[model samples]
Target: MPDLNIPVKILGIGRYLPERRVSNEELARLCGRSAHWIEERNGVRERRYKSFETNAFMGARAAENALADADVGLNDIDLILNASGTAQQSIPDNAVFIQRELGERAAGTAAMTLHATCLSFLAGFDLAASLLLARRYRTILLISSDIASVALNPEEAESFSLFGDGAAAVVLSLAEGESSGLHRAAFKTFSEGAELTTVRGGGTQFHPNAKMTRAEDNLFHMDGLAVLRLVRRHAQDFLEGLEPGLSAGLGAINLVIPHQASKVGLRSLERYNWPREKIVETLSFLGNCISASLPLTLYEAIKSGRLERGDRFLMVGTGAGLSMGGLILTY
Candidate 1:
């Protein structure tokens, strides 16, 4: 028999959301469009918003809960990894602020930030698993958080209806013996489509000049048609590539967690012939939270008893940079 054991197991999971909730009708009015038009195009009903806090603060709330659920004290955590597209300030990194809020003992914890856009959390999972397997740490906290609402342009209907603010966290620990956990992880990218989805300004490519408008400086942009095509192709490719490594048959996989981009993106998976009962979506409630969406959806699935031990999960993520990744977990 294949050795279907994982060296690291999830100890706990948690999520945090902001106070403000913007419904589709409200957003449509702000954009001078009909709510039906927005819903037909993006399938977003509402999204959360944050007014006066940084991503680190939002992320820490979820991390604190995960640590509490795991029954692990701050001193017991050996590493902290933040996967966020939005950091309060670019310098010192969000991980430093998280470490500071976690206290002096936590300040000493090995911490770093991963910047893989929406797929950052999946990347963090791979890194944490590798470290645990290497005996580098006993307990690790992984946080996926972003506040895309901060970058929204009131003029952009596509963005305002989709992106949201939220955070999700998971605690992973090295397993002493055979235990259920992360089975396999893989990632791939296609930069050819990078321009199809991105923020146009603020990076090295386009430094702000006098001609640059506020819309260009602050808004998220995307070639919706292009992204739709690329995601459908890659989602299928990723799932097919991962099928062989899964110990359970396709029907046995318990949950399929995907980024909360749009209903269109989520519906594209239906063509893959995967079991319909396995998919869990939070798009209707949370909107697209970028890096935090997938994990937050998974956290909700677990909390609602939609997931359980011995169940298999397949997580797929894609974001700007035209990047894509997938991971298989046995829990």
Candidate 2:
């Protein structure tokens, strides 16, 4: 069994939304669909988009909010983690840039990045639990942000209408309490889903330098049907793997703050007998912000009072690796 005794607690959470909010009507015009058609399909009325903000820039903004909310001074941060799917640039990671923008006190602080696509936040949380418990760092700042709209294919309404731009951050600190920190965590990946959701360009596999590189290769693509099928097959096993962590079982989970992958993506939990009301959702407004979805939805849940401190909640997500992961914890 994995270590289920980590004592790190979430101090604060914050998110930053782009200035522009694209409504379904605006999106329908692009794809030649009716507003009602879009809404009925994705359950997304609108979503934000990054007009000029860079990924790292938006992440810095969200980090400031979380740090202030946590009542933590910049000097108190021991490490900065940029846990997102996309990078501001391919060269230097976004961690140091965020730390620098955060404030001078954040200067000289150790910085790094963890990439797990949409599961970035949960992956960071799982890693932080182990690292914090080991005393490797006193206070850690993890930020997840994505601007997926730029790369979306306009013709692919199913994918484009479901993606948005946003950022979310969380502050984690060591604390003493059985119900205040992570109790259990698990993740599963299926390489068979490698092509289900992909952006084939920008990497060595489809490098610009390569003669065969196509413009479509650089844009985001998704085999939505394949993704749904794959998840349906694995959903049960994923839940079963997580059952050992809960004090009770699925019903004992106060809330399931899931990734806002889609309308169907969230509803898919119904098959596992999860209560609809117990599932926290931000997809209708925020759509899918890649790595930012979970953290942003989590921020919404707490702000809306759907979740409370000491409440055992499960954070779950499915992403690019055809990966599935979850953390059973008390917020």
Candidate 3:
């Protein structure tokens, strides 16, 4: 008998990029730096910034595309999982807002949000697999949406130019055949570097209503070098633990869809001797959309015909929790 506990299979994938494209030149003017400086550091030429899109609006748009790709409808989705690092509001979860944007047909669908900074999508995929295997849901809509551009700090040119706004969605269902499913997954968190990347306001600890809260406190911040150092120290071991040949090279993997963290982060893959051709990246155009980065990259790979059914690929990234996670899947 086929193993009934395998990871959920992806039925369809979709992405939504805002119409307003912010070029590096625009960011350079805002940061008082040259466009070349921004590109050289972040590998981003341009990134989308929402003119009128909300997190829910973008996610719903992506979800509609995914549903169409899957040949399904909003009512067909039993659960909606928003894996965004940022929410539309502080009260109800982001998934609820997505459902609302999806219209009345999705009114009674179950909704939840899973957040682990940039690894939010991976966390949702992991959880969805388990829930599907347990017969908890028939089909699930997983979304990762973030408006990183709005929260970016212009004072921090490196990080500010490395972020963008976008959303991606995937339709997942139980594997109908043994050929496609998640192979193995692993994650590790090192809180010692937790302060390396953070947004200090909006949460209870730094509530916006608090008199001491400053506008700067709500902006995004990152010590890229510090976070890279911590990830490098443990990446090799973590990869080997997830899958044997992964540590040595990408010989067994067809493609790698990684979070568009930064130019430095993508370059780090070179250390594993993984061929540049085998890695899928969207940083140059989309920039880092927080948790939306990975899934959006995956969508691009699929649309570009880089990943195909029965091909084995790896999805991995480091998030603000100072966490690293990997998922091996047969597409």
Candidate 4:
């Protein structure tokens, strides 16, 4: 049986990428490297930048696009869930801003956020699906948006060169129509990697006002090699934790939309027996959009005709919390 017994479907999907394109050369100049150096190391040729775009602004625009794509109206969304990797602000809740930007169409609705770093979007997907099954919400707009550029340390070329800014969102509803339904969802974590990938500053532990806060504390950092090694070490167990459902899910899904985390990490999925051609990747061009990575890649897959309705998919990735998550569903 699938993880989710109740049928749920994505009614629409949308993405908003900034017009300012940052090529490998531009990022290289910032880090004192060549374009080839960056690409050869991380498989990133270029990435998008918010420039003047706020995370909330990009999110709202993406939400609009998704609503339009789903043919869903503002009034149709009963819940607005911001499942972003980072909030635009520490207060006021970024979801409210997204709701306002969605115009009056989003009035009189509940808005909230569910955070798990890059895994937030996948968490939101299951959240919306569960709510639909419980009949608490008729429709949901789940969004994932992050601007890693601002928090990046240009001096940390390995990490800095691999980030981009963007947002991707989806409209989900109970499978009352003829569209495909959500079939399964699963998430696993090894908290030992909690500090492996993190933005050590801006939170309660590393606040700006803290006397001992170092400048680098506020910047995003990842022990890239360590993370890859950890994932590889736990690869079999992690995949096994996903169980019989996962085994079948691998065969059942038509495409795999993975988090655009790293070149080595992505290629490792093939070791699980997944077909190379069946994986959808956007890390080379889009960089890692944090929480937006999965959905952004999903948008790319759909736009490129790699995905179509009635298709089965497995969305999976690892994130800051040392988390591994994936979902099997029919699109």
Model 2 alpha-carbon miss at residue 200, Å: 0.6
**lDDT of candidate 1 over 232-299, digit per residue (tens):** 66665565566663323356577888877787888766776655577788888788999999889989
Query: Residue 243 in candidate 3 has what lDDT?
Result: 81
Per-candidate clashes, comma-separated: 1, 0, 0, 0
The reply for model 2, stretches above 4 Å from the true place, is 1-3, 244-249
lDDT tens digits, residues 1-331, model 2? 4648677888988899999999998988898788898888889999999998988889999998998889998789887888999976777777867776777777899999999999999999888878888899999999998989888887888887888999999999888755687877889999999988899998888898899999999889999888999998887777777775232347667898989988888887776767788988889988899999999999999989999988888898898969999888888
Ranked candidates, highest TM-score first: 3, 2, 4, 1
Q: For candidate 1, report its TM-score.
A: 0.92
Question: Who is ahead in lDDT, 1 or 3?
Answer: 3
Clashes of 1: 1
What TM-score does candidate 2 reach?
A: 0.96
Which ten contiguous residues of candidate 2 have the minimum total lDDT?
A: 243-252
RMSD (CA, Å), candidate 4 to true, equals: 1.7
Q: Write down the TM-score of every candidate.
A: 0.92, 0.96, 0.97, 0.96
Of 1 and 3, the candidate ranking higher by TM-score = 3
- Alpha carbon lDDT of residue 328, candidate 3? 85
* CA-only RMSD, every prediction: 2.6, 1.8, 1.9, 1.7
Candidate 1: segments with Cα more than 4 A from true spot: 1-5, 208-215, 245-249
Q: Give per-residue CA lDDT, model 3, range 91-130, as digits (tens).
A: 8777889999999999999999998989999989988988
Which candidate tops lDDT? 3
